[model samples]
Target: MSRTVFCRKYQKEMEGLDFPPMPGAKGQDIFENVSRQAWEEWQNQQTMLINEKHLSLMDPNNRKYLQAQMERFFNNEPFDKAEGYVPPEK
Candidate 1:
């Protein structure tokens, strides 16, 4: 049977991840509190942010910035947008 977690992002009980996403305390926290669906969504957003900002994971500062962005994204806090990216005219 699949596992369930109280997804912090969705604010509902949902299917949990099969394994810890990261390596340590934060990964355990996510495993205990975040849902698979929410994690996937964050992954997609992270990809876009990385590509848009031309972030190099090899750089320590870049990794730190991405980690901060990930936290803000999951917590429903405001986050940075790609430079020069404008919303489509509504």
Candidate 2:
């Protein structure tokens, strides 16, 4: 998901926790960094799972599925087409 969306979702979850606000952090932006890190961790886990299972995530249908998810995360806007903006190859 987009950073903002992820942050909003995470912020909601975090509201149920007892974590204290970080010093000097913006209330609204509090979850952005943590959410981005979480997303990265999630991607790594997915990659590891695929590798361990010898899965072919490179299939055309798989590519489309991933693309759609990315688009959804991006608020349904077209994904970046600029060179070097491609999603993970796998």
- The runs of at least 3 residues in candidate 2 whose Cα sits more than 4 Å from the true structure, single-residue gaps closed, are 1-9, 12-34, 64-90
Worst 10 residues of 2 by lDDT: 12-21
lDDT of 2 by residue, 1-90 (tens): 232333432443322212323345532233333355444544554455445445477687755655454434424344323233345777
Candidate 1: regions farther than 4 A off: 83-90
Candidate 1 yields a Cα-based lDDT of 0.90
Top-TM-score structure, candidate number: 1
lDDT of each: 0.90, 0.42
Quality of model 2 by C-alpha lDDT: 0.42
Candidate 2: residue pairs that collide? none
